[model samples]
Target chain A: MNINILYAALAPIVAILLGLLYIGIGRKIIARLQRRYGPPFYQQYIDTIKLLAKKTVSSHGVFFSLGPIMGLAGSMVTLLFIPFGSAAPLLSFHGDIILVMYLVVIAPLGMALGVGEGSNPNGSIGMARGLTLMLAYEVPFVLALFSVVLYTHTTSIAQIVQSQAGEWSLLKFHGFNWLTFALPISAIVADICLQGMLGEKPFDQVIAPHEIASGPMVEYGGKYLGMMVINHALHIYIETALFVDIFLGGGPVWFFIPATFSVFILSLIINGVLPRFRIGQALKFYWGVPLILAVIGIIYTMVVIK
Target chain B: MKQKTEQKKSLNQGGKNMTEEKSIDFFEYFIGPQHPGITGNFGVILNAVGDEIIKAQANPGYLHRAFEKLMEQRMYLQNVPLVCRICVPEPDVNEALYSMAIETLTGIEVPERAKYIRTIVLEMARLAAYLFYFGGTAATLGLYTLPNWSFGDRDYILDLFEELTGARIYHIYMQPGGVRRDLPKDFTKKLYSLLQTLKKRIKEYDGIFFDAALFKKRTKGVGVINKDMAIEYSVTGPNLRASGIAYDIRKDTPYLAYPDINFNVITENEGDFYSRVMVRRREFEEDIKILEQLIDKLPSGEVWNRYPMPLNWKVEKGDVYVKVESTKGEYGYYVVSDGSEKPRRIHVRGPSMTHGIMLLEKLLKGQRIADISPIMFSLDICPPDIDR
Candidate 1:
């Protein structure tokens, strides 16, 4: 019982720390890819702590404060369901994969809504752009996610991981077939595109400083801006972790460090190389090419795996 | 959900116009000050009837810094650095125009080497400024990669400026009689190579952004202006060139070393946003060619004039209005000298005041909200010039 209590308490702390680590490492790798000296590994943590200690300032409405809180809550909620180190999740339940996906979206959605409630026209425009981007990237992401479930034959994330363990790992289970491999590759591309939509460099259209001067976050200042920084770090962390869990098997303790670093470096390389897609183009990609590929992957899985 | 639907319906229906008599509803829309379509810190309050803009009032001075008023208080020499701030992007033109005005007033002839160097600097500045214009125009059409590429390349040119002028954005090197320093060893050779590399890369830009079908559709016939209206409104640079005007200050009134350099004035007869973009596109080639020619013909001579010391120097009591073909348009400075350390009066005539404000307002009228941004970009008007 005491062990269970400790697990409950430490689970959030460990998961949150991992989330923070993911952001720190991801930033460093992206910086390196862009030929820059990225921030130190603890940069995200320091930023978060700094934000929490500062005073919050709001321009238009109380919803601005509520937005970052909701983002934090979404991260915390996702952290609860995702299993760590073969341990049982803090709040595991049936159909939690869908909940995890929905939670991934909640942070940006809340931030967009809160920014739209502001009086600034630029802020509203930025929010509108962000929403358009959300619409563009989300559908392909959902389809890609469902393909993983179809292959594993379960919606429970832990069971999916368990299915990938050892000799029965999808790579080995499918004899490392090139035809089967296309599913994850397509999913990975979709994830990278989605990450761009999530507001990193190159595809940072919503908050393009030269064009709109930080866009939706333009009106936010002081501690409210600080919370935004923390929220962004958490969002990146969760997204990176989701990629790791989906494509990469939840491997042993020794593999975590290298796997984390490798996945992070891949994301950074992608971010550094590409330029942003306009909202319209992004919509076309998500609804058009990626959707077709995702359907193909799902149909292939249904026919072959069963 | 039901209540939200009802609220949305009421808002769209104007709260009760359908069930009763037709109310006089003159739709007034505030188009900017912070709208995505507006270029800088400025707004347009428009009263429209359907798709046509009936009444338009420009609420400029959003980025006003009172630069003309500020210049009146500074010394004639002190005004050099300050003038560069007037148009932040292509600052070399400001420096050149001001210096030429001072030279005219003082009756000082610049050294031949300094003249060539100034010409080179001016061309490079124009290229840099046009690169920025191309980037903005591409972005407005939702073609995003070109901006990333252009901005990255422009920084390389800024490095050259830092080496020559000891300042990146505003160079105070161009003074009354000549330049501050001579050319670095092999400067022309290096410039030639960079131009070669740029020529190769431009084709890539043409492939990705310029020739893309969507951009073609968006920009082709939008924001059209003929030569008559362009001349009447005092529009200049590529904006004027787009209206089929063959006039260029370099050709019409040859200043500095332009009489020695052979180059054609690029113009397009389309008189539309696409034509404006195309003019800049062709001008980018012309600027590179001019730079290459200037580099090859550079004569060996002293760069600076043996002018008197700064403290005792005074100009002859005279007036001169010198105009230069800047990246944007005709950048002119009119000076009145009373033979003191400072001038009695100085006036800057920047194209952006005509193009960004007056011309932009006129061109934007009756245009769709979508076309507004690309039209502003194609005009290539710098906001600081308008504000100054």
Candidate 2:
């Protein structure tokens, strides 16, 4: 019980640090692509520490002060619920997939509540865009999730990972029994949804600096902004790790780290080249292409299950 | 308490019935003078509902240095440095236009070689400005790679300028009678190589930025100025050409060595933000061809014609409006001289005076808030030009 308690304590710290490292490395990759000598891979760690160390922090009210805390708390809770690999399902329960989904939303909602109290139109608009974007991407994402759950006959994330473990005889795919190969269409749809969830262009409208001035975090500064940065790092880990667990066969740590980092780097490469879509355009895209693909994937899953 | 009751009564009476009335809450915010997204030290007061802009007012004067009024207090030569500061990105246009105005009023005919040299300087400035436009427009749309590439490429042009004029940004090279100095040794060879490098790099820009589907989808038809509207607003340069109007000051009024050089006035019919940007993109190539031709035909003679003694020079009483085709638009200088060392009055007609204020305000109405920066950049509205 003490070892389990210690593992629970260690999981979030490891996740946050690894997430920051991925972001810093992603920045370096984008810089190299653009012919620039980017900052060191630990630049995010330095930035977070510097921001947290700053003394002055302005607040609009109780909600303003509570916003970053709530966001950090929400991301922490979401991270705890999602299993990172085979060895570490920190706080995962039998029906935690549904709980994880609900928890994933709390961070942005908390952010909205806090930014609303700040009385900034940019922040409000950012929150609105973010929520609207959430609504758009969630449709396809939920459909993909449903397909994965139905194919494996489980709502428990651990069972889902166990289901993807053994090899299939009909397809005779050898090395890894990841669902990405078994349910290819659903996996593709989920990856597209992941692009939106990650907030990389051509879908990065929420914090479009040129459009609305960094959106929800426009007025946040000092420690509040620092917390948001930490929350963002954790948020990245949670979203990508969830994808890995569902599609990539939540293997040991060796497999999990590379799989997650590759997924993130793919998004970063796309982000470096593409311009942002307008909010309306983003909605239209999510509803049109990925939505139809998601519907087809669910139908395929249903047919295969029968 | 009475005022509150009166306000409530007025609100109720303004509509026929409360159930039939709808109130829109406009979110008003200022987008710079301190914001990063803005092009320069400029501001746009945006009144928006949701993500759509209901109204946008161009808030100029943040970078106002009263350049026109200051020119009145200085001599013709003294104002050359001051005028260049009016437009930061492409300062050579100001120097050329100011010198052209003074030369015309004083009737100081520049030498044959000087005209060629001036033409070379002007085209180089235009090329540099277009490079800046590519980086800035791409950055506003969030394709950060193009900015890194194009801005790095622009430094090559600035290096050439520095070698010639002893300054990188504000090169006060164009003097009243002619250029301040002749071309340095092997300058043409270096320019030819730079053009070769740019020709190769432009394809990379096309691969990443200009031909990218997302860039096209974002910019096409976003900030359109139809030909009729373009003419009504007196839009000039690449913007005017983009609207299918083939009006080019370089072609219509042959200045410097343009009459001898062979180049087409690049135009696009769509008149949208994409067309505006494409016009400049094609014009970059056209400018390269013009510079190559100028170097091939550069004559060997004096670059500067001797004027009257400095610090006591006087001009003949006259007024003249000399205009040049800058990268943005028709940059004109109206100089009225009462035959004095300092002119009686001078008026600078920067292209941003029309494009940045009236055209920008008109284009921004009903546009999504996301498009504000991209449209401003597409029009190439340098704020200092407007403020000055």
Candidate 3:
């Protein structure tokens, strides 16, 4: 059986559908937390369809149209690199985790480029904040990844998952996970950074609906928004899947739904109960407590934990 | 750092750039007739050099309905409904002040029991408005949960209002001499319970919103108004109080039953955004305390004065001004009668006319663009107040 050909065609469609479903469910969950009768679980699909059905607007230029497509493509390619539990990476390589980290950026860069072309100052402000926040959170997140990679001695996510088969990474040795517990600080930092990475509340300055008019998405309408929405959905899945894989052991493809949901709910609850940080405050916080935690976790892993 | 120096050089270029800011590095963003952070049909034209706002022009009149001029055409009693629409968050202050001014003009003394009832409704209205202000200010800092919770909590207050006045938002219950009706049966008992629920919820809110790390970080040192500036701008209500003045219309110039009701004048020194918000939070407790006093000592008697409020009600040729401590600040009304059915003039001085426009323009200059909403919300600017 030729797995490459099979996955190339099927994976993106399946991933996209699953991504949309997750987003739909996520909205319902957050809505319930606020004690409102939320929109239907399939609301994202309906919203996307509605957006697509609307008449197109005059584009700022060729770049504006290219932005969404490029963003979607960047995410799709990143999705292919992330292994779905037991399944091999669609394009596996020795240091694909690093590649995944850098590739994840392409989507936002695409959005930034599109926003730049639109010439909205608010969008530029929002993009600047987003990029600044990205710098803030990425450090701790990368440090957490480094802790795991150094401990496991493998940069490939597939190899890391395979190594965890005898015992899930969270409960590797007699219900005591070295990476999570021995240096609990790293895991805690990762959890906090994940909130920012997913663009939830408290860290949702970029999509600030009131402040800057949904920031970069202000001018987008019809198919442009639809493209961004689908891209957003895929972005959610990729990030959450990455978190689950690194910490919770992505497990078999069968456990993917439940595992991904647990992480989603955790992120959702954190998002629901808190107020937002100004971009400056968010930067200061990321560099303050979380950065210290990541540093301590890395030292512990290097000196003793591993 | 580089951009600042470059912008400085460009600013020095000063020829065509001075004539048109559009040609310069600066750009403008219209934050509202429909912005989420905006209060009613208002907007702010923010000119920015990078993320910092250089100038902010307060845009009002989008929600204007000329209530002052409208009052001139309507009968004395008829204008009561129109004045309440001036500030939507706490309409009772307008109602109370309008009624007081009219009472002074007509030389009609309100019944003692009606005064007590009016006092209770006013306190409840204050609580309702504070709840709204808290929720709204939190929303500006990106706390959606607080609004969801606070708005839900406010409905409990509204439910109480509906039970007493038969209307939720625009009660239109207060007339020239007194309120439209007596308290509903068991209304006092229900209010007692609602206060307890609110007290508990306020504590929970403290944990989730007020005490949250991000909120403190976002608000602290952000929109500081000095005592001198506060007085200069006539920034009344909690905003002025936040700048260290313990002045309150309820305490300073008592009306209705407030002269008898003892309460603390909540004040703060720093007058920063957080101080303004905390002042409102403390005032929430004070409002509840005042309501409790009104409930405990409520007189059981007639709730209206002995004047038939005919549609064509007339008053003598006299003018009087009355001010009430509203949720936003000192809401005032001046009414003049020409011994006819209609009033000669009626003027409203809403606190937001000062806070939302002139003070906002001052506070916004040189501040980060993100702080505009917080500063506006913390000041408790009701755009309808300005627009009206």
Model 2: per-residue lDDT, tens digit, B145-185?
Answer: 89898888999999999999999999988889999888899
DockQ of each: 0.07, 0.50, 0.49
Q: Sort the candidates on TM-score, descending order.
A: 2, 3, 1
* Per-residue alpha-carbon lDDT of candidate 3 for residues A1-306, written as tens digits (9 for 90 to 100): 797878877877777777788888877887776667789999888888999898877577888888888999999899888778667778887899999999999999998899878776667778888899999999988998888888778999887666555444444433233246545777789989989988998899898876877888876889999989889888878887887676766366766667777777788888888777778888998999999888888898898743
Where does model 3 exceed 4 Å of error?
Answer: A1-3, A167-183, B1-24, B306-309
Native contact share for candidate 1: 0.01
lDDT of prediction 2: 0.87
Q: Tens digit of lDDT per residue, candidate 1, span B248-351?
A: 99999998889999998999998998899889899999989999999988888888776577656677788899999987888989888787876778788888
Q: All candidates' lDDT scores? A: 0.71, 0.87, 0.82
Candidate 1 lDDT, tens digit per residue, A91-184? 7766888999788778777887677666444455567677777777777777777777777778887776556555433354422322225366
Best TM-score goes to which candidate? Answer: 2
Ranking by lDDT: 2, 3, 1
The 10-residue segment of model 1 chain A with minimum total lDDT is A173-182
Query: TM-scores for all candidates?
Result: 0.78, 0.94, 0.93
Deviation (Å) of A54 in candidate 1:
1.5
